[model samples]
Target: MVKFLKITAAIVILLLLFYFVFFKYRQIQANKILIPATTQTLFKINVDELYKTLAVSYLKHPSQYAGTDKNSIREKIADLNSGLRIPANIYIYALKGTAKNTLFTRLEIADTSAFNHFILKKLALLKKDAHFFESADSTFGLLVNKKTVSIAFNMAKEPIRHILEEIHDQNNMVKISDSKFAQMASLSDHLSFQDAENLSKINFTDGKIDFSSEFENKWIEPAAEPRHRMLNPESTLSFWLNGKIKSDLTEKNHTMSLSLLSKDSFFRFYQDYVDFEWTKTVTQVDTIVGYEYNDDFEQVEKKILRDRKIPSITINLNSDDKAVSNYLKSLGALDQSTGKISSAMIPLYQFYFRGSNGNVQLSTIKSAKPDVKRASSDDFFYFKVDFKKLINQTSIPLIADKLGTFSQLEIKAKSIGKNKIKLESELLFLNKDANALMQVLKVFQNGFKSALDLNLSVDIPVSK
Candidate 1:
């Protein structure tokens, strides 16, 4: 009994060792395929890991994960798994050539015939006699081989075929372990992207999609001062630039804001003040007398109201140098009296000016002020858009329908190292309980449905 127990333990240990060794080998192979020749934009995804993430997310919120199409999505994934090799990394990269950049998708395949059939069915293409296929518009091309599949966008068929052949023949392709951007591949569980000077990683959490990018350039310098205090929380859109103005050759920081008067007033304000060239169809009725029988005839004429939507915008400048401020005042652009600057070019709107001695605020609305304290000193560039407010205020159905999922988008860039600047952006979702990736899929599904509805509603004139 002691010997048997010892033998059983030995067998278990051997099996565990073998499993880990094989896993490590597969990982190394997968990473080799992810390495690109040129340092352009490259996206890598581990299909097996992503599905595992989806499974956990589904278990957390089954009903809200992907809604009723959850099963459909799983079945489609299964179909793909049967053809393509799962538990492997797939890459989509842009190959930069002399003239232009070509986008290529490279993935390992398990069953060539099955994947070919899958592609044909999904693209609604008939089975061709050759292994290579191109779309009718020459925008998409596909090449299939025994071990791998290559897809190119906006490229010709011959290039993709040649690329596939070269990839197969190349024995000394660079491995991800030996590449400079290898660290980015490990940043995210499922997705990572790298470019010439930037490396980005994306993570899909429960509520929000987190995207972080690092810009590695020696020319990036830290901001001299914090400018976040100039931004208004109530503004629908805000942007800040902390640098010198080339035209005036002055070192000035600028902040711009688009503040809505009220939630209900945005559409009306936009139509009245913002859109200067917008036109609306109107019918005009005119009275006319018939020449032959003395009968009264009503003549109708269509008129267009050529008014466009414009929002009241505010621009604030902060600088220690008074050159720009003095120049604007001298040019009659910044009036010191009555705190109003007349708009000579655009007669419809006038500007309100306040402040002097380098710091200034110029706005179309008299009540607009730059007293909001929302700026971060660490960030040199900051931008924010309130999608929720825009969706609530807009009367357009398409804009509201498409952008209803997002609440706010905020992007910030800050210096992290001597030659590195980290960019962080968050896309807040309305549904906090569901997974962000699942919500993205739902958005695409809804987009497709909306497109189909639009196509069906279009009136086609029948030719006789």
Candidate 2:
């Protein structure tokens, strides 16, 4: 019970109540659960890395993890290589010989459509006094006997009396050349994000939620509002998020822009407990990042930038540097320093090669309008967005049905001695501890006067 209370800390100040360790994110961290944000990131994992991850996991070869389709190779890549480039004249074999090259060099007849069309043009040119030739083998060429036979390869057509003949085929299939498939596995076990980096987006299909919270007052009696409230009314009521309110005892002059990437309803139910009403509607979606294929076929991706005015909630911050909080304001280092990301970078970049490679990017358009206003002391700058992009999938990182409008997310677990097992679960927008999060910080704002101020700090006292 004591530990439970510590995990659910609350601090209330006059006109403001700032909860620490926003329970949503905190609880998420505890859960070690991950969700991908499909709209604002780019991931280019080498195909080899996936194969390696699965190879080391169990008795089965991990090649499958990388995106191989052949069951015979299972997790083997001994012979397959992504770096090998093929020419237009060449045909690839999925499996070894039967007839033909099984695979062949680019045959003149290979590009049947283009060849037929070319022959038509050639015939027209011949009638127009173009010279024709034949090669030593009697095949038609630019010249007669020493000429070449360069007609289109489609025997199923008229105008060109021809027989279907395959020059030769190569014996090739997805047979791995080497036995040591583990050589090409992913070296890194964990996915890392950078500082000032946002990650793993989640979506709540319907009635999904999102939220952040902080805990305060671990020692106070359960649910006992912290002591800051009596001194600063603004601190206990409205949070700086809605609109800043004043409190003589509270620190002032602050600026902050926080983002919550989650299923629209990740924390909605919690807000419900607090009687907080929130709304979200996607106004406009702009595609920002698209692929510019280089000569090598490597993609130079442009990031997507979306302009969304989370309307209803006021955009009150003076950017990050100029702040209303004395602590933040006094810092000269907090200048309008630009970080790495910008207009050129792709915002919502995701790669899907599990079946076939695909890309999707979306930006928020300027046409979007959003407004958030606290009707009275009871209201906060509260809004909800189901950031979950349902790929018709319930699985992570894998879109199950390429043809269907859904994505599957499958959670798997393993105990050292237990057989590999997959689990089924669905995420929703409800917070079991929402009442605890709202208890963090409340806000009271008067557009004319500055809003309240309350410093929230969350400290966890248990070992997971």
Candidate 3:
């Protein structure tokens, strides 16, 4: 009797050990399916883990958790999860192959009985369509196995089985090439949650999602330029962008600096360049013998050599000293004392320049003394722009027409190490109650403010 009891116990222990090893191995295989071979876009959701989180939250704050019925939520969740083959993670992929546009999802099912009871049993209750042989929807297909199940939807007119077979084939997968994929995988593993990498890989074709048709050359490379160290190491943002500018003024390897200035400095520079109306001087000049009035003159001509400040504003630009000097020389800089240039140097000066001297007063536009701030480090440069002044003074039809719509605008950029730069800007509406961005801007002067707003940012990397 003792020997028989010991034998039974040993068999039970062996069975438990085998089951544990199989479960672990299955989990490893399931994770590998998250990233398929060929796919335009990928999405993942960890339903099991997410449910656990919600369950914990509900336990902590029962009042905050809302539900329509008073049924046992935990039991329902357990039943749903048990019905799913693989409840921990669900992966969704957008693929383009035999079918022009199709969506494929792979699910691992552990308990076929539970799944049938919850889904297939319920589906059985619905009347079947005789022509389609299943349900009225001809776009969906379900392939079931003892351990796994596959569901697919084809937006094209192609048969559903063809789309399902294509997704099931491992060789048909298309992979996205980017560091973002690796980062997403790392995040998913860390959090034990469902995560996605690239969903923008798809483009619309015939009102359906398809892979982008554009092809990028992988062989051609850009030649390296002699590394020019950052001018301001402590600057806010800095990076190298290798691209050609249309103008003949700058080289292909153009280094740009972004910085901020105080409100006073910004206003001072704007007023000097754009504010040019002449006021009648009250200073009494020595009476001099004047020529006799001509028939064209209405009265004693008030033309006199009156002293007035030139309409010139000095600003420290992002370019090098030599570049700044060349830019000024291009604008016909005449004054050597203060750094100032003629309004003619600025493109579209006709609309923005309000100077009375016209072409004759070109020399009157002198460079103001530049408030040059040296960079403490060779990393990045920083500067602020007064958009209010820009909107008021700039006469460029394209931007001028749009500037009045925005109530507040602020821009900031920062360099992440030597290769990447991050830029952020905000445009706020004066009326927070507005629904659309255009509406917010149009009514910005009306003192309306909305809690909702539009925001955008970008991260750029410069290759070494």
RMSD of each: 10.9, 29.8, 16.6
lDDT of 2 by residue, 14-63 (tens): 21332223423332332231111111221112222223332333234222
Model 1 weakest 10-residue run by lDDT: 269-278
Task: Encode model 1's per-residue lDDT on 1-464: one tens digit a residue.
Answer: 99999999999999989966875676666766644455356777766466556667668767663323434655655654438775456767766551145667756688877777777775644434466776766567667668876667754433455664445454335666666657755543567877778777787876688788887845434455645555456667777755332223222443221221222212221210110111121222222333332235545454444433445567655533255345455666556665665455224445566654445555665676545334547777677777776655457776666677777788887767676778899898777766677666556663443111111111222222
lDDT of each: 0.58, 0.24, 0.38
User: Please, what are the lDDT tens digits per residue for candidate 3 over residues 1-464?
Assistant: 99999999999999989866764565445455544555545555544434444445446544433333554546545644547755444567665353535667867676778865655454542223211122345565666556665666656545665545444454454332232344333222212211232122221111111221112222112112212222232221223222222233324453322211323222222211111221111222222345556688745644445443222232222233343344345545423344333333442121111122211122223322222232233212223333344445444554444444434444333333333333444444333332222243223423543222222111111122
Tell me how far candidate 2 lies from the true structure as C-alpha RMSD in angstroms: 29.8
Q: What is the TM-score of each candidate against the true structure?
A: 0.68, 0.17, 0.35
Model 2 — TM-score against the truth? 0.17
By TM-score, is 2 or 3 better? 3
For model 2, the superposed segments whose C-alpha errors exceed 4 Å read: 1-240, 243-346, 349-363, 370-373, 377-464
Candidate 2 steric clashes: 133
Q: Please report the candidate that would top TM-score against the real structure.
A: 1
Error of 1 at 33 (Å): 3.3
Model 2, C-alpha of 98: deviation from truth (Å): 72
Cα lDDT of candidate 2 equals 0.24
